[model samples]
Target: MIRTSLASAPLRVLAADATPVFREGLRAVIDRTVGLEWAGGTDHADAIRRGVRTIGPRVVVLDSAVDPTCTLIRDLVEINPELMVAVLFRDHDRSPASVRVAQSSGARCLLSRDTEASVMVRALLQAHQTGRYVDPRLTMVLSRPWQSASACDAGVLLTARQRQILALVAQGMSEPDIARHLDLGAATVSSHMKETRRRLGARDRAHAVALAYHVGVLPLRPALVAQRGISPVRPAHTD
Candidate 1:
């Protein structure tokens, strides 16, 4: 089958940030990437609302500048229930506590502004397909004592091993593959996966990945993935 290009893409994407430069950067990424269209972007929340209503994009890459607390994710979702959002973490709002709040705000994807373009694309695609994703780097920040205390005072924490296993799982790695990659027996990897599920209270692999997005521990570089059979979900919309 021929690859899909952005122009023929069934769904569009847009950027929403206060900075003109940031919007341009997103536009560039969208222009260069396949499977997405640049539906244009805005610097205001109201404009973003209008754009979503008008453009009806499948995904939006947003900056916390629209709302420092990242509450806008929920509001944007309210406007278009099928829309997926990937939040950019500015220096000011990249704290573990803020990131946690943003992730908790139903943000499926959270990545630093400087994350690689491929990661950004993967994030937008991931959230669009699965409803959850977060840059694994953010997990380091959240693992800190102060960050965890502030973000998840409930004290729900995953060990580094657990985090690594979950990250591999998110990469669509199988138990044997993960075991081989990590230089561990298949049983060991299986045990770790089970424990991770228990810690995250996930019903299965998919649920565990979704919950990992909540705790800030999946999807990032240094852990490569071959995401196969990924097809975007384009919901019906009215003109």
Candidate 2:
């Protein structure tokens, strides 16, 4: 059953699709919805991260075909763990492999590339508020899942501390704040972040977030729209 919650605040949303037409079309649908702030849209993963951090949107919708790699999801979650990611897959070829990849990267909702605007809006609102959404069809497939964890592993073994750091980073915690929370020196935290990036082959902080999500190291949350004229929610203050 899909659980519903009354949002105490508004949800800010950022969307990215490789194509302008798709982005615009989705934008129009989302724009008409109440209690949502369209925080702008982009095509690049790096740009998406920047927008999320700066805008602090609670939900992000992405195109799976354009940004199919796990890195796309991982990076978003790594930088904004609280942000929910919704993905649209092409209806013609909604393969299980693609669905699993999307889920592994923390996509809360997966819809057919051809999903109707109303359905998309409903899914978006659900994901934004609760961090979980499932297409009935996709849920049936996931129900059969029994793969060994090793089979799903990507070989990016992380230390326990590294995992904690990645999760916090995904939650949008600043490096200094993470250091303070971890009770470690800022320089040491910096070193860890640098090393983590190097190991993930990440190009930058945003890239690191993408790479982490790509590898299933982080997961997307629910999508929530902010009320009209209200500011979006930021990650909880770590100070």
Cα misplacement distance, residue 88 of candidate 2 (Å): 0.8
For candidate 2, write residues 58-169 as lDDT tens digits.
8888876556555577677877777788887765324444566568667888777678777777787877666678777766654543222312552334556776887789
Per-candidate TM equals 0.58, 0.56
Q: What are the Cα lDDT values of the candidates? A: 0.69, 0.67
Q: How far is candidate 2 from the true structure (C-alpha RMSD, Å)?
A: 13.3
Best by the lDDT measure: 1
Candidate 2: where is the Cα deviation over 4 Å? 1-8, 140-239
Every candidate's CA RMSD: 17.3, 13.3
Residue 234, model 2: lDDT of 24
